[model samples]
Target: MAVVFVITLAMLTAATVISGSPVTLTLERAFPTNHGVELNQLRARDLLRHRRILQSSNGVVDFDVHGTFDPFQVGLYFTKVQLGTPPVEFYVQIDTGSDVLWVSCSSCTGCPQTSGLQIELNFFDSGRSSTSSLISCSDRRCNSGIQSSDATCSSQNNQCSYTFQYGDGSGTSGYYVSDTMHLDTIFEGSVATNSSAPVVFGCSNQQSGDLTKSDRAVDGIFGFGQQEMSVISQLSSQGIAPRVFSHCLRGDSTGGGVLVLGEIVEPNIVYTPLVPSQPHYNLNLQSISVNGQALQIDASVFATSNNNRGTIVDSGTTLAYLAEEAYDPFVNAITATIPQSVRTVVSRGNQCFLITSRLG
Candidate 1:
């Protein structure tokens, strides 16, 4: 499935555009301003290293998530999202790691004022939208969607408040609110079908840690996780879109790529079975090989025991990680194949060699 950051989805209606067919959304690289290839590599490397520091933790938000950034890798790829009536556009990160979409709300504290990505940062004001409504504590979505132990409905109107703490000690706290979102669905690389879908999202009033850091900040994040609170699930449940989506990432020179929802017709595309009864899209890893040579390691090192432990294919993760037991063997095999003449260098925890001559 192509993980999608859905802005809006509508039941295919004759008034707007075709229904039951696939629709595409355009995506632009979040790091258009950072031109250095080495800097980008270092940023990606840092993110990979951060993986070692991560551990399973529970926090708020429909999906308890922590967001991290290196100024160079802050915006890997994001899309334009229009929220509220008299719509204001915000460039939001399309994250598949978590569920529940959120944007910094008006009167936000510690949110960035300026972003190096060349887009003006803006806050979402529910008061400004005539179509906006609050999700209260008594609401079914409130009771079931956000499973945080600290969730409380103590407001005068019983408004549901949320606290989202990330693994890296960054977090946001806010209340639940619903508003209209505008989306443009592209067809055949030219024509766009405009549609609006109503969605409930978090309007964060506070942000801390990396979220407060201005160097890599954006308007917010749009999560495409495997939960009822996710944008895809909301659209699918409302009959506005199918349960499947797909996206293609293009090179820097190509400007950007395409993200599509519903049915994608491509004969060149192949399919894989999703590991059953799992939250994220997971698949079993049977073996590891580099350059057609399978590494010498026990296959059981990649095995899963508990239902939740396994390898997952996530769109938000830019780096691949392996168990330390598996990592050593894999690294040794790769280094042995490199020519002795090329000197190796480590930058931001990434090992590399600047070789002008080809060696197999």
Candidate 2:
């Protein structure tokens, strides 16, 4: 349900050591999935063996992997959410592609009421604050004029509804709503700051098939990418800079990804040159080269013509999917690298290599 940005790190480093502050946001509540029920019961060793470990090489954070959902070219992670006031936890996916953070609603149809994963934060129940509102169909932010396919948004009781289809055909659908979000900010070693920001999110009331019943243990996602409305946008509005996030995919919970608020941790890490592509808004991509060879693909493969900078460089996807032409060359190169003994031919005429052992 949540969209998370993931980065691989070889080791764990302190965020405060690299930056001035180390903010820790802890979730003490239980999730609605079976993993939530059994998380504490299992010993550390058992948990380590069963869970997909993620860490941040340069942050003071760690978390367990609830489950993995692969849709489209995106891979999503479901994790536990704990807020102090609610005393309950919910499962959420961490996404970096879009902005807005939301969870499943208690009143949502088919949503788990007793799963113990709902966010019970006081901000949600405060009589003083207006209930988080949903975006209307007439609103400009809502994608309109399209039939309710998995890619398009729909109108529900005047609110915009969303359906996200992953590359693997797995997706989630729900109504969008706004809510108050809080992040524990760390400043200069011992200084701590807390800020509340408004976030737009999807509260899926009903889900079916693998989506409704996932091993990931969460019902929603958190988008923190370069999109206009992502959590980073809110942070920028609050005057936080150098906002960067790093997640260690192969480490312990104590070693998690760092969501940098205002600056890059190291200048060298930022050395990767950013190339601009025209006609596409936020989509930024140079040619994709395999090993040392460059592949020819359509420029449209980066992003829609209207949103160029919107090009997403995602690590979650297991395979590098590009426009058909680009995919062809990459596949061809791989097949050429292997001998006939290790290659298998498929009915679609695609050849796959069977690896008997590690290449290294």
lDDT values, one for every candidate? 0.67, 0.47
lDDT per residue for candidate 2 within 87-205, as digits (tens), equals 23555666554444556655554444333323332112222335456667775445521331212344436767766665445555666655565444433322233445555556665
lDDT of 1: 0.67
Could you give me the TM-score of model 2 versus the true structure? 0.56
Off by over 4 Å in 1: 1-75, 147-157, 167-169, 186-194, 251-255, 348-350, 356-360
> Candidate 1, TM-score vs. the true structure?
0.73
RMSD of each: 14.3, 12.4
Worst 10 residues of 2 by lDDT: 119-128
> lDDT tens string, model 1, 8-62?
2232333233486665554454333435345556555554453332221210011
Give the Cα error of residue 165 in candidate 2, in Å. Answer: 5.0
